[model samples]
Target: MEIKIKNLTKIYKNIKVLDNVSLEIHNGVFGLLGENGAGKTTLMEIISTLLPFDDGEIEVAGLNVKKEPLKVCEILGYLPQKFDFFPKVTLEESFDYLCKLKGMNNSESRKQEINLRLQEVGLLSEQKKYIQELSGGMKQRFGIAQALIGNPKIILIDEPTVGLDPHERISFRNLITRISRDKIILLSTHIVQDIASTCKNLMVLQKGKVNYFGSTIDLINKVRGKVWLYNILDDEIPHVDLFVSLQDKGSSIEIRYIADNPLQGSISTEPTLEDAYIYINRKELTV
Candidate 1:
């Protein structure tokens, strides 16, 4: 399956959320990285046919999102950043209802599919729990289960690991990576680590524009020799405007700084996707 978005634009009153954005995505786990209000969600909403655009075109699986919304919804599964459900519904009931809406005829097969999805998301044990009684992480898992009701060909997930703990985040990411082999999974997130670890390819958005789009390695290579590592005491740290502190290890701090000349006692460190993202955005904003 493929998605083509051409010259897509959206405006709310005087503010332009998406500015002539265009992209082509195929089957894989593609990451959409951007800061809050950088138009990632707006683009996803338009492509998913949830929100209309002011201009341009979007086609998913060769069907236009604007003209064939019902067709798009038939193969599209979307998990918005924040979703609400009936407070009194059990997990199994919720999944069953969504499956029926998706046109599942065999009740036994639907139940089996629901149970499989629940197990995949680590929520099978909580099948009988009410929506209001589950914890936040479990609720997010349940939301994921609903999105998988009809074996959607295209899945769009926005910030899938927003408020979960470290362990829960790992579990969620693992599940997503495992299921991405057979479908097109579009992931939009502010967590740089998630993009680095999960997505094979990524697109960085800045001021509603494509700042960088390609392989993660290529993006990191843009700042190859510019990243420098130095170990310094907390109080004796140098005052450099282009330095980013990657970590502080008690007595010694590992820092990444940008300088034309190599500093004494400082070693060169490889640039990561996070480093490239920061460098690209800072460069654009300053110019």
Candidate 2:
């Protein structure tokens, strides 16, 4: 599915959560990187048609989100930053209830579908466990299972890996990557490594505005030659603004820095996506 947002704006009282944002998202895993209060959730809500925007036009899969919300919802699956489930309900029961809410009526077929989704998310073994009994990671997986019930073409996941441990996070990211082959999966997160390893394209938001958006390679290429590596004594570390620090086998310290001129013990260094993001944001902040 194709998602297009144009001149989108949202406000709560006098605070603007989204400031005339515009973006076009196509099939693949597109990462949304931003800090808290950067409007990531607000943008997701507006795109999912869960919240009305103060101004803007959003079209998903060729259907207008505001005017044709029902159609939009039919092909959309959204796992918000904070999801709630019935306290006393079991995982299986919760899926059943969500299916009903989505207008599914065939009990047997729904159960089979839910079971498949649970298995896909590695939660099938915990299907009979009560929602309250599940751990944070389990509950997040359950939320993902519920979001996949309708075979959505456009999936929006907000902070999907927030509470997951390193192992679970990798598993979840892999699952999302596999599922994104034919769908447009919008994953909003603050983890640069997540985007670096999983997403091919990304959008970086700063203060409710898009600071950068494009292919990951293009973004990383921006800082390609600006990064420098310096082999410095531990005592000299404080003199450089280290972008990355590593310990050498010989007790020397290797540091990546941003400098206009070559330092006393510096060499050219390759920049990573994180370096590009830091450079862009730092430049923006200074202006």
Candidate 3:
């Protein structure tokens, strides 16, 4: 499935949260990378048809979101950042209930489909477990399972791994990558590593505008030669301006930084995804 968002704009008070944003997304995972309030959620809501836009158009699978909202909703699955389920309901029962609500009849074929979806999310073994009994990652997987009930053409997942631990985060990312085949998976997250590892294409939003939108490798290449690494004693920490990150060594710190010119005794280093994000935003703000 494909989503075409053309000149989409949304206004609150007197400000435009989504300022004439346009994007074309096809099958596979497409990430929206930005900080909170950068209009990621606003744009997602508009595309999902949960909120109205003041201008422009959005089409999903050839149907206009505004003119044929119900048609769009039929093929759309959305997992917001936060959602709640019946705490006492078992995983199987929860999926059953959600499927019924989505108009799936209580038939043998429907039951089997539910089983298949749960298995795809690796939650079939936990089908009898209560919602409260599942870990954070499992709960998120369950969320995705429900979203897959009708095998929707497009799925929108917002900040799916924020509170997860490192292991859980990796597991969730892998799950997303596995299920993204043959569908449009629009993922939104502020975490750079999440995009770096899971998404091949990404858009960076700043102040409701697209700062960079293309393949992940091209984004990283933007600041390739401007990154450097410097070894410094603790006393020199306060003097560095473009320090991006630091690693603690026995007697010194290894600092990765960005600069327009090289520093004395510093080694040129390859730019990371985080470095590219920082560099892009810094340039946008300075301009």
Candidate 4:
């Protein structure tokens, strides 16, 4: 499957939310990386046929979204950042309802599909649990299960792991990794670690524009030799430029920052994906 977005633009009132954005995605897991209000969700909404764009074209699975929305919807599944299921219903009932909404009329077929989706997301044993009884991570997994209802060729997941413990985040990532091998999955989030670990290719967005688009390793390599670690008194921390990360160490603070020239007593350090992300975004902030 392939999604082609060309010169896409979206305007809210007079402001440009997505300004001439364009991207091409094939069958694999691709990430849309950006902070809040950076137009990542706007682009995803346009591609999913949920919001209309001011200019440009979006084609999903060879179908033009504006001209054939239903056709595109047939092949698309979206899990938004915030979703609420029926609080009073069981997991199976909720899945069944979503299947019905998706136009699945055959009861036996819906039954099989619901169970299959639950199994795929590792919630088959908990299918009978009430929606209100599940934890945040389980609810998110159930959200994913609902998105897979129609077996869409393209799936869009927005901020799936924003508020979870580390263990739950890893589990959710693993679940997405397993099912994304054969489909075109677009994982959208601001967390650098999410894109670094889950996606092979990603596009970084800044103020509704593309800041960087490439393989994860290529992005990381951009600031490889430019990052350094320095120890400084807590009062001196305010004077450093390009501070990417900071850790408090009692009387002093350890700071990892990006700079063209290293400070005195500072040692060069390896670059992480977060460091690379900070480098790019910080440049934009200064500009």
In terms of lDDT, the poorest run of 10 residues in model 3 is 278-287
Model 1 lDDT, residue 103, Cα? 91
Task: Identify the leading candidate in terms of TM-score.
Answer: 4
The digit string of per-residue lDDT tens for model 4 on 47-143 reads 9989999999988989999999999998889999966687889998889988999999999999999989999989999999999999899999999
Model 1 alpha-carbon drift over 4 Å, by segment: 234-237, 260-262, 283-287
lDDT (10s digit) by residue, model 2, range 1-287 = 68998989989888988898889999999999988889999899888888998998899999999789999999999988756688798888888888989888999888889889998988889989998899877888787778888899999999888877998888878888888889999999988888888899999998888899899999999888777887866645545543554557487767666656657767887888888888767632221
Question: Model 4 reaches what TM-score against the true structure?
Answer: 0.95
Q: List the residue pairs that clash in candidate 2.
A: none
Candidate order by lDDT, highest to lowest? 4, 3, 1, 2
Ranking by TM-score: 4, 3, 1, 2
- C-alpha lDDT of all candidate models, in order: 0.84, 0.84, 0.87, 0.89
Candidate 3 structure quality by residue, lDDT tens digits, 58-138? 889999999999888889898888655889999988888888877788678679978999999888889999999998888
lDDT of 1 by residue, 137-179 (tens): 8877787778787889999999989988998888888878898
Segments in model 4 whose C-alpha atoms lie over 4 Å from true places: 283-287
Model 1 lDDT-worst window of ten: 278-287
lDDT of 3 at 85: 82
